[model samples]
Target: MESSSALALSQLPYYIYPTIPNTNKNYPFWPAGKRRSSQLPTRLHCNKMFVPGFGEASPEAKAAKNLHNFFTYIAVKIVAAQLESYNPEAYEELMEFVGRHPLNDGDKFCATMFRESSRHKNLALRIMEVRSSYCQNDFEWDNLKSLAFKMVTESNTRLMRDYISETSRAETEK
Candidate 1:
């Protein structure tokens, strides 16, 4: 049998050296007689392990999580509205995929089937209706409104100017 002590330490670069017995605290791998003024060169594994963006600590991951949460809430509302029962098996399959996959994957999956036929179009509209209900109730459409305001203010086009005037008049009347 090969003894562990016979193995060279350098071969296992990732081995935590501090765990070894009788290794004094002066340095991780310092020889007992070493008395140099300079410290031993420390090996720092600074490279972080690659984490997938779908569920990692990144901002994109956070946004994807938020989107998935919102999608789940919308789906629950759709199910409550009896729309889910109309196509029980399809709804279950979609929910299963949504639960397991990332938001971008879900979007790609939906887009691929969203316009395949009239039935798909109708289903897409129903999903949109569910999302609209959530947006209306949660007051979560502010970003879109802000974007529209930005476009209206920045554009010097005649149509935009007309829209600005019409909105301003409507606001005054209200």
Candidate 2:
């Protein structure tokens, strides 16, 4: 695996460009036996891997880890709520069936019919409720608020605005 700089060193057709290595020629400046350059290119790729936006060394890795934790927390909350609110035998049977099959696993779990519905806030809160096991005295919805903000800002802000205008126009026609 040659570095781009190393490959570049091979491309000098004329007297090597001063920026790249060109020891192929028998330059008299070298000792009678020296074959290659003594220096190596410094490796610092800046386009793709960047410092984290919030002062993190590995921004992308941290975001990925946080998202993983958040998703796992939500999944556990969903399962626990389903178990607490339903019959364990039914949930177990459903897990067993899905365990034996290729599937989406969460939405298609069947026994969690209501939890899989369209009420995003309710679903998230219920998951929080299950995970926190608290009643009425603060369920930590704020923990997910930042994630929700990011999802809205990054994923759907423009689409949602356009959809709202489209829906308004369609409603006016009706």
Query: Residue 106 deviation, candidate 2, in Å?
Result: 19
Which stretches in model 2 have alpha-carbon errors above 4 Å?
Answer: 1-36, 39-47, 52-57, 84-174
- Show model 1 residue runs off by greater than 4 Å: 1-61, 68-73, 76-81, 84-106, 138-174
| Reference-based TM-score, model 1 | 0.30
lDDT of each: 0.56, 0.51
CA shift at 91, candidate 2, in angstroms? 13
Candidate RMSDs in Å, in order, are: 19.3, 16.6
Which of the numbered candidates is closest to the native, going by highest lDDT? 1
Candidate 1 Cα deviation (angstroms), residue 69 = 6.7
lDDT per residue for candidate 2 within 59-121, as digits (tens), equals: 656665555445435555466557656767645643554355333443333335344444433
Q: How many steric overlaps does candidate 2 have?
A: 0
